[model samples]
Target: MSAKPFSQGVKSPIVHTPSSSSTTGPEQDERSTPTADLKSAHRKVDRRLVLWYSFVYLIMRIHVSNISNTAIINLEEGDGIKAQLGGLTSQQWAWVLSIFYYPYMLLEPFATLALKRFTPRLWMARIMVTWGIVSMCQGATVNYAGIMACRFFLGAAEAGFYPGVLYHFSFWFPTQRLSFRIVDPETAAFLSGPEREAIIADLPSRAPSMDSKTFDLDQIKAMFRNPTFVPFLVIWITHGIGGFGITFVLPTVIYELGISDTAISQLMTMPAYAAVFLILLTLGYFTHTKRLSPWVAGIGLEVAQIIFYILLITVDNATAKYIFVVIATAATQSFFPIIWPERIRATSGTTSAGLAIGITNGVTQLMGIVGPQVYQPKFGPSYRVSYSTSVGLLTATVATIGLTWLLVRRQDKRTEAAAIVESEGVGLPGEKDRTKQQGC
Candidate 1:
């Protein structure tokens, strides 16, 4: 929210925001943040929140991606889930998988707004726990209606987690390091007194909307006008539908490949995820150390997906098929994370950041709604049809990334020009006009 460009984060100031109810809070004065003592702050964030949130998000992902794996949990013995649930038809099975996104898409935005009402740690833990319970209920379900109900509730429970984390990050770190922090005076019970002060001291360098209201229609409305909004939405649409489609059916695809009995089919699915994790780790490093823009990161990853999806569609060899699956999953999941950093960079304040991210995430949830149907049983053996769809979507995602980058770059230049005008406008009108003339 500062005039200083923070899309890269390397030279960005260390700004913090506090809760509205907190006695100690962010400074409201604008000045260059002292970069000297920020080491402790960065270390603290990494130690306390980074690894912890990683684990938390990992659990959420495993749960989200588990349905496809769960479908084959007790397979080969005729005791699979579809068999338990009244021998669900292909359409019925698709609906059961798709139902999870209905509430997830609808409630995600409002659920993100509730972070201020319930506080981050409390609200997020509730979501994590509730989804776990809902998932547990799925294991106990004995009928089609019961499974459908559980899936729907599961979607409702997980609705806010992603966007809420994005909102939380806006308060603590700039775009890149934001993958790893959270704090406020009211909630800095984990920090020493000085450490707490360091994060919450009142300075204009403080984040712009630390004390913003729980809901702001204006901010929500502004999101539509943000240069990056529609582009972000389009990328999410492709990632969610295509990326999720691949992930949701991967286990079944492996199974259909004659990977043999028992759990080998399920176990083999693990490698693709491992590859995804490694790709994400590497991408984070590039974003952090190299100051890589999300557009560059996203485009590179989407291109990888497009390439692999093409290979997957055209290739016929069994071993190569498995290899391409891993590549496709890794490309898509890694690319999916780039949107968040770009989303945060595009929006200025907490409200805009939260709502915009929520909206984008909501659109991505369309993946869960529409993804499973892409891999219906009719297209089994070698689901080239689905692979073609992914290739097409990934191609679209690449174009959207370029469009978003161009738009965001244009906005950035405009902002920089205005910031220059304001900074030089400090003197006589003639001098200001001369500065503007020079800029022009």
Candidate 2:
């Protein structure tokens, strides 16, 4: 019985299994992410980010687009009345629109730098509050100069909002998640609708009173530090130019196509309204289902806008021109939301994302100020100038998107390479032995 019991003693291995709680031994490296785990995380985050972004987009669209419409219409109305008072021309009207860019453009880089320090939420709230006040004030102007003053401040207030939002979207969606493209079209659509509404609201008989209010810069400064804004800058700038070209002249073009001012005003709003509805629907389904590439959707819409402008301008027939204007209006309005917030998301965290988005939006808006001038024509048909300018802008947007795609691809490769190098233990010169000694 004693001999039988002696045979069962177990032999121990040379290396002891390190206790889970022990920190003294080599730190265990976490294994690479499992494919299923990575995919699951991507899918889960994609749905949530898209859903949240879409909701925020809807709110913004209602406010910003309406402001854009009101600003231009008020400028036109003020100029019309001022022309009777001081005998000003359309060129001065163009200047009123163009001058809004000077301060707006100058502030963006500084704003961009500032985003490195703030949170997006605070920054956006500040921007919205200021612009909302300025937007309202455009209605109160009794003269062209007064309108001009309001427009200038309006530019200054809204400057950083779009870019900042773009920065916000970049955080939760990586390139593979396909959310970056989601920002622009949605934004365009939202802005377009309200713009149309403002146009309608300002009808010869029924315009709403506008107000000019002040906001706290301190709150804006606070949003500069929040980090989540990597994607916002590029996408915002890309689509910003396109938006300017469209918003600046789409109404005028519609008028040229034999549409009545009343009909044009009401019809123009439809494109933006439709776009908003579609964006909300698309974002809810696409972002949640992980079924759409924001880049593809955004670029495709931009291309459609360009084509619409080309068709509208080149066709000799009035009926065809009218048809194209409607089509272009509808299509162009869809890009804003998809592209805007996505830029902010790329920026990283919500705060920096906000700043980045604000900067991009602010800077790009300078294009809006400059746009009326560029398309206003020195001597002749401004319609031709406006439509052709839009073509150039849309082309640039496509190029910018191509560059962004490349950047995203390179980033993916670098991520993969770093992961591989980390796994291979190709430690730096003196670090290998140190790591071994530390049992890492």
Candidate 3:
């Protein structure tokens, strides 16, 4: 073709195929692939969140499971109040044994609120050290009443740890990555990357980073607005009743295993450390991998407890019963760290993280109060009532899991549908665009 000449003398040459870098028509179509890549990048998990979550779960694993270990230790040593104090009966022993769950449950919800008010590291460390001291005190008690008082204080001091850790989990992980982030180390870290990014991205918006003495009030306010809060209150209530019920029977259960009281106490200690290690491993892996739901893992273990209880009751063979007991102990203990944090995050970012956890602790603590009373030897030595009560309470926990699952699933569907609509540049056909007019 002839080239176009100077001063519009000849017809202009026709443009052919556009270059790859063309800036003309259909530029929008060329941008679509890069847009998708950006979206995927936005969804990637952060690393720091995973590390933090694993650390918190580790602390909780030690805090919660150690109670059983210590009780077992005391039983093995024949260090129970009845052994130390004169004129004490099985019923009184049971009462003292069951007292710890009371304050622990009662304090959980409120403790969650406290998590919001203070720095998690400091507050959580304080609770842990206090409980550790209380546990040490239990070792020193001279009589039944003294042991009883120690158990009560132990409950009060330890009440906030699990829920506080959970509230911390929520602040970092989004729904897509929660269970995996908590249980699996690698995946959890992946999920936390975005969280760190958001904070770092906002550094310009915030005043220059300050010393530990200064706090971030804005982040604290974000917790209350978290939607997962209300449903978890009900979940924590069930956990309280179950934890106390089972704890009250542990010593007696050991007695039934055909072991001497001293040996039983020592054997129970094995599971406490076992729980800490197992939880750290499983949660660290599963959360990082994003393979399973923490709720599923926790509820599954509680349901498994029914089988163990049945084995303990039906198996006259001492060796078999002891084996089942060990298995049950490990499984049941693993759930606490996983469940509490998952629950708190559902309604997180409130100034009330500490208070919410504290309340949960208080309510669950009542299980301690009633559990020993119901299983007293005045009813019988075998204490079938205690085992049956545990079975029933665990069943209730399974039901709670199912209900909570359905509720969370519904919320997830809504969230997903909203996300899809936003990506597609469309509005909900019939429903009002509330997110458009009002901020989420």
Number of the top TM-score candidate: 1
Report the lDDT tens digits of candidate 2 across residue range 1-440.
00000000000001111211110112112211224434454344335434554565566556545533443343335543435426546677677667667677777645533332444435555766987788788777766687679878877776644443333333322222232334121122223454324322221110001110112243244333322222334445545665555566555555545545533454565665566456546653564344555567677878888887787677778767766766666666566555442342232222333333445556566566666666553423337666777687678877777676555444333333433555677645554332222110
Model 3 score (lDDT): 0.49
TM-score for predicted model 1 compared with the true structure: 0.85
Candidate 2's displacement at residue 18, Å, is 33
| Residue 190 miss distance in model 1 (angstroms) | 3.0
What is the alpha-carbon lDDT of model 2 when measured against the actual structure? 0.46
Alpha-carbon shift of residue 194 in model 3 (angstroms): 11
lDDT of 1 at 43: 65
lDDT of 1 by residue, 261-284 (tens): 548888888888788668776666
Give the poorly placed runs of model 3, Cα more than 4 Å off. Answer: 1-80, 128-150, 175-234, 248-252, 268-288, 295-299, 340-342, 351-362, 374-381, 419-440
As for TM-score, the candidate ahead, 1 or 3, is 1
Superposed by TM-score, candidate 2 places the C-alpha of residue 344 at a distance from the truth, in angstroms, of 5.0
TM-score for each model? 0.85, 0.60, 0.63
